[model samples]
Target chain A: MNLNVYLHAFTGVVKREFWRFIQQRSRFLSALVRPLLWLVVFAAGFRAALGVAIIPPYATYITYETYIAPGLCCMILLFNGMQSSLSMVYDREMGSMKVLLMSPVPRSWLLISKLLAIALISLVQVYAFLAIAWLAGVEPPALGLITALPALVLVALLLGSIGLFLSARIRQLENFAGVMNFVIFPMFFLSSALYPLWKMRESSEWLYWICQYNPFTHAVELVRFALYQQLNLQALAITLGTTLVFATLAVISFNPERTVRAAPAKA
Target chain B: MTIALQIDRVSHQYGQRVALDNVSIGLVEGQFNALLGPNGAGKSTLFALLTRLYRVQQGEIRLGDDSINRNPRALLARLGVVFQQSTLDLDLTVMQNLEYHGALHGLSTREIRRRAAEELEWLGLADRTKDKVRSLNGGHRRRVEIARALLHRPDILLLDEASAGLDVASRQAINKAVRQLCQERGLTVLWATHLLEEISLDDPVVILHRGRVLAEGIGRDVCERSDETSLDALFDRLTSAKEAHA
Candidate 1:
């Protein structure tokens, strides 16, 4: 009821998440390693095959690696968001989630706090990825890096909310592997992460439309524009709208009462 | 005796199967009460409802005159719970676990430190405060959970099978510790278990069978009313009779 109480609870949840993240050294390493591999190895191989036009975010011709850097950054957020949801499932199975849900703070705020924690952690990894890319000679303007912070946070929340919505619907940890295959792969591949929508349109009209409608595409574009010291109003509006929708669904589905109904009956 | 917690006409069903059917009970303030039931007798379901892990489907639960449905936050703030499973973060130290619980209840840092010291000392875990929970034995881990549960100084302590999966000595140790809290701190305790040996004749007991309350009263009175001399006999007879009738 009191502001101090909510503040204390928020601090507690975020601190526990950070502590857990710290202890899981492999998780941190993998979070960074996944995108770095794509940026360094995959992009290098594809540089000759894929050609990028002067997109709105790109003022001139850019190499494939440079073009995919923003997409790779969004990839980190996307994966971390799903990873955070996976941890929520783990927590639910392991009973630690009960300790969280049982707190007197409102469940909606607790969930948002959780998403915020994931977003904060994802930001650290994104910046690390950007730094690594910068060292690899993919440097954006210094001010652009500063400008991208808010945009990155927004995309992280947008992706995290989608993940939270999925986590709420997912019954067991085992089913998550299927979700990764079904959801993560399609979202990543269908988006403009690897290639531009115009490239997809040249290949197949339907694929182009799918990429255009994919929320992840907008998320990537938002980050791409922000990293170039520009704002894409259309991408910003779509990303914000999708984030709100998914966050609302996540909160509703994660209601303790609804979750009980969703749980399989046990003896 | 004051009833610190009240469950009124609560019913729950999972699809077509009834988990609890029109169940109701009042827990005595400042006493060790037992909710004794078999594996599928809806004990966990009741615990779920009480903790608000599941919504109350058909009845109301009141904690010290506040309806849980109307003011769940207020009621939950006064209730401390140790679930059937261990809820401790194994990677964290004993003190860290307690500190997390204290913060969830919105306790100030100074207050958390003071209570953590007192509770851990009382639970004989003062020396192990710095040890990660994963390093502790089963008994010690349960003790840490108990310590964490009491860190907020809640009026009522609900332990749903808190002694499950521990050695006999560990179980007895936890049982004694909670009983002491009832006597010394006037903290109402609801200890749910299927193990009959954990119930003493003088303890308040509720026997649930097949989603219904078979009997409830002081352990001695419930046994006497059923014309049984021991709790084991009374439990078997009551549950078996329900099984036959069904």
Candidate 2:
């Protein structure tokens, strides 16, 4: 209950998470590589095939790589979010989750602090991927990087909390592959990550609407606008709203007293 | 002596399967109580409830003056637990694991460092403080976990079958270490074990079978009341009758 203890606990958890991220070099590498492949390989291949009209966020025409860079940055956040949840599931199974929850703090505070640490780590990967994108010539305005920081953080927190929310429901680690298939793919592909909603509409109107409905689309749009030094009020509003909603839901699901079996010992 | 922990009329079920049934026991401060049960006799369930890993289903659990229902978090601050399963992060060094636990318990870094060094030295593990848990043997990891549990200096320590997989020497060492803590520090200890030999004849014992308390008192006294010569005989008598009824 002491304020200093709460601060120390928060710092300890975050520092432990940061060290885990550092030790697992492969996880960090994949976080960057997954999105980099999209920006460097897929975008280049699609560049000739796709023509992006000057969207509101884009006053001038843009290359496919430039168009998808922000989405890909969000992709790193998305994957890291899921990865952190996977570790949560792993921790639950391995018994480390008990060590965490036993901390003399509110369960909501513990879970939110954990989510924030994950989001912070995800942001590091986001900025790292963005740097690589810039070098690869998927150029956003230099100052846009600074402006995009807040939006990028909001998007990461939103996705990370969503992942944390999903984690509270998963009983087994193997279930994560299913989450990637059902949650991650749908959120990404059905959003504006690969193509604009109008482009989806060119194929099917309902599918385009689903893309518009997907919160990832708004997150991507938010980052896309910020990266161009523009503030799309609607995107910002939707992203902020979704962040609060998902974070609340995640914290609620993680409440210890509700007592879903922390992890049943395998027979 | 003041009672450090009291459990009254507690029962729990998994769906329709009863795991604990109206079980009650009181542990005096600074006393070591062996929660003796067979594998499925609800020892883990009771430990789970005591540690607040699971909610109390049908009765009251009191730690010091705090009740589980009214002020559970306060109760938790006064209790420590070392689960049967290893909870130490295998990839983290002993110091890292202990320091994190200390922070969770709200200890300052300087205090954690001093305690960690003191504890590791006591466990004869000071040389291995920097070693990752994965690099240590099962016994060593268990030792580190015990140290971590004590780092917060809680009055009550609940150890659920804590010596389950250790070698005989390691198990006895762990047992001696805890018993010494109880005697010297007046730590209230609930040591859950299936191994009868881990308990002393004069130590308090709670024998649980078929989700109910079969016997609870001084170990040899329980044996004498049950008209048995040894704890092993008493335990077998109680549990087999359970299997026959089932």
TM-score (0 to 1) of chain B for each candidate = 0.98, 0.97
Q: Positional deviation of A229 in candidate 1, in angstroms?
A: 1.2
DockQ of each: 0.64, 0.53
Q: Write the per-residue lDDT of candidate 2 for residues A1-267, one digit (tens) a residue.
A: 779978888878887898788879999898888998888788878888888989878889988988898889888889888887799888888888888877767777777788889988988888888888889987788999999999998998999899899888887899998999999999999999878888899999999999888999999999999998999899999999999999999987874533324323310
lDDT of 2: 0.86
**Over 4 Å off in model 2, which ranges?**
A255-267
lDDT of 1 by residue, B1-246 (tens): 788899999999887888889999999988899999988788888888888898888999998768889998888888889888788999988887887788888987778889999988999988998899999999999888888888877889999888999999999999999999998999999999999999999999999988899898999998889899999999999998888999
**lDDT of candidate 2 over B57-171, digit per residue (tens):** 7999987679988898888888888998888988888999998889887888889999999989998899999898999998888889889988999989999889999999999
Fnat: each model in turn: 0.58, 0.47
The candidate that wins on lDDT is: 1
DockQ of candidate model 2: 0.53
DockQ top scorer? 1
lDDT of 1 at A45: 91
iRMSD in angstroms, per model: 1.8, 2.8
Query: lDDT of all the models against the reference?
Result: 0.88, 0.86
Q: Global lDDT for candidate 1?
A: 0.88
